[model samples]
Target chain A: MAINPLPPGAGTAIGIDGLIALLAKLPGLGPRSARRAVLQLIKKRESLMQPLARALAEVADSIRICSTCGNVDVQDPCAICRDPKRDAGLICVVEDVSDLWALDRAGLFRGRYHVLGGTLSALDGIGPDDLNIGPLVDRVRKGDIREVILALNATVDGQTTAHYITDRLGALNVDVTALAHGLPVGGELDYLDDGTLAAAMKARRKF
Target chain B: MAINPLPPGAGTAIGIDGLIALLAKLPGLGPRSARRAVLQLIKKRESLMQPLARALAEVADSIRICSTCGNVDVQDPCAICRDPKRDAGLICVVEDVSDLWALDRAGLFRGRYHVLGGTLSALDGIGPDDLNIGPLVDRVRKGDIREVILALNATVDGQTTAHYITDRLGALNVDVTALAHGLPVGGELDYLDDGTLAAAMKARRKF
Candidate 1:
């Protein structure tokens, strides 16, 4: 993780350094990669960077969180919540908006989503109140949701949050389930951990 | 590469899919990473994305190439070319603006620069006239320049362009030099090719 040696007032000019600094903070980019990206953008300013800048502005201006499901979109209820074809009775709960986007990219789930923002982290002082668990329970209590799928990550905090949500929804008549734990597609058995292997073995299905 | 399965009118919201598609075309980003970046941007719209949009607009509006050195900057002459501290007798010739940016990041060279835009690639129909070679030669022929350092890449085209420039500047009194060819710092010997090894041996110096 080498820091960008070029400071603000160095040989590099103007907003270019600032853009690189901001781009470097992205999830998959470091300073070097950010510099490369910025150069590429500057070189293809008309074709790429300008369009991206415009698109970013448009998205920034239009995007908002769905009041119903907590998903970010251009509309209040979001496209997913507004879609008439998706199953409103099936709500998929995820830790963050990124998780929702990932599932959407998979194109497998045809249900609405509930973004919890983050899992219940006792160490980090994140409780059920800090998340969207209350709203999710309220959605279930409205008698529209038939199934509440806990599609959170297979982490300690994720599981704890799921359990807490289940407890909160204990009085509801809806069924609750979780994503199946098993070897991922194209995954090798040798690379799997003990917990995953145990869970896979316990839940083994007949072919 | 896995194509993004999410189509234009799929469950994903409007403008978001387009943004992801455009972002995926960047140098180092893939569809998955682009999706993650977009989600992150949307998540921190007020703090990060909005500011990025503003900075991008500002840069796009202000950035232009310097007439003398071809360096991209907010000013016409560019800050470097207008600086009175730098050496006017030395000029570093590079293939593209990105190369000039790389050298500027190094912060070692006090001389100005000449961006050739591209090498003399016969395969791609690029020739001496297509690049900024004529202007470079004109600048050298003016007799103020004492040295022209060829800071092009180690590629075959780069070397060919360097040779062509050398020939073009032959009638002038300016001295032409190139970056030294040797093993890069922190490079593993076993991983190096025979050409690099030979070059390193031929240019060996007593420590």
Candidate 2:
């Protein structure tokens, strides 16, 4: 849908509309929902919008990709990567930061993470260079890393990416594990319940 | 849920978590949906966020309330009121801007608007001073306005607000009409299908 232009200030051309537009690009939103959201934000601007705007401005200013794991972070190395309490030897490789966050929410995985920006997609021409595979290989090559957890989604592309990473990490002589095949085929890691995720982690087998 | 703080440049301290927190305040959104939306925004930042940020900044800079119609506008009189083509003699009174926009989208009413901002709510301590009833009555008295359409929402508070305005406008000797009771109980004008709104308008009786 096209945004109708009005004489700037005399019409609805403002932050609220832009916020709604941005929100509409999300997975499960449309123009109507977006409009409703914007109106709500305006009605509660002081408590909601200001905090949101400040948060947005802050994120736009300081967000950076983690140098170690490629997770979105304020620092080069994300908190999970820098934490000494985490098991650095066991790196759970996930497709995106959201997946990493999901694993963190479970509070079961005390291991470090290797966020592969995205899965290997032949149709999309994504290859080893496009992901953090090189760094993952290097981290394993250091000989300190032991078990590498492949926590990719259950899609075909995800499986392909998992196999490719498995093969690469294989050459490094580290134990490779996939997070169980019973993770409901074609499901996203983010959609899995905590119990299911924990079960999958528990039932993980050597790939 | 607690917001996970990021290190320097992981984005901002508030970063995506901050954005999610802000978005969670919107109507019909909770923390889970907010997180999903924020992730989607970050993924499509180039295509969606850049333009959205510009729109937000622009709107944030210029948005204001239309002094005459009580509609949110960048100007005092608003485009609909200032437009010479729109029937200045016919004024459509609405409880909120959404109602005005809904009527405008129907493309049937070529009349000016009188936005009440909200309906009277005794529980919320809203009275005549809280709405634009005074200005609406004043407009009817000063302008050549003939028909005043009472397009208030079909709620107890909405009816109270409409009656209050109708009583005030009655003094100006204008023909006051309300959209018919064809609207569903507790239904918002914005949710009515276009045809229903049009039919309701055509079947409107005197208030």
DockQ of each: 0.43, 0.36
Task: Please give, for residues A64-167, the per-residue lDDT of candidate 2 as tens digits.
Answer: 67788888776666766676678878989999888988998889999888899899988999888998899889888974988999999978899899999887
True contacts kept of 2: 0.41
lDDT tens per residue, model 1, A67-119: 98998877666778776789889999999988997898789999899999999
Per-residue lDDT tens digits of candidate 1, residues B1-207? 233345424434447888888788888899989988998898889888988888777787778787887878766677777676889999999998888878987899999899999998889999888898888988888749999999999999999999999998998898999999999999999999999999999999999
How high is the CA lDDT of each candidate model?
A: 0.85, 0.76
Runs of candidate 2 exceeding 4 Å displacement? A1-20, A123-125, A181-207, B1-13, B122-125, B183-207
Candidate that would win on DockQ: 1
Give the distance in Å from residue A135's predicted Cα in candidate 2 to where it truly belongs. 2.0
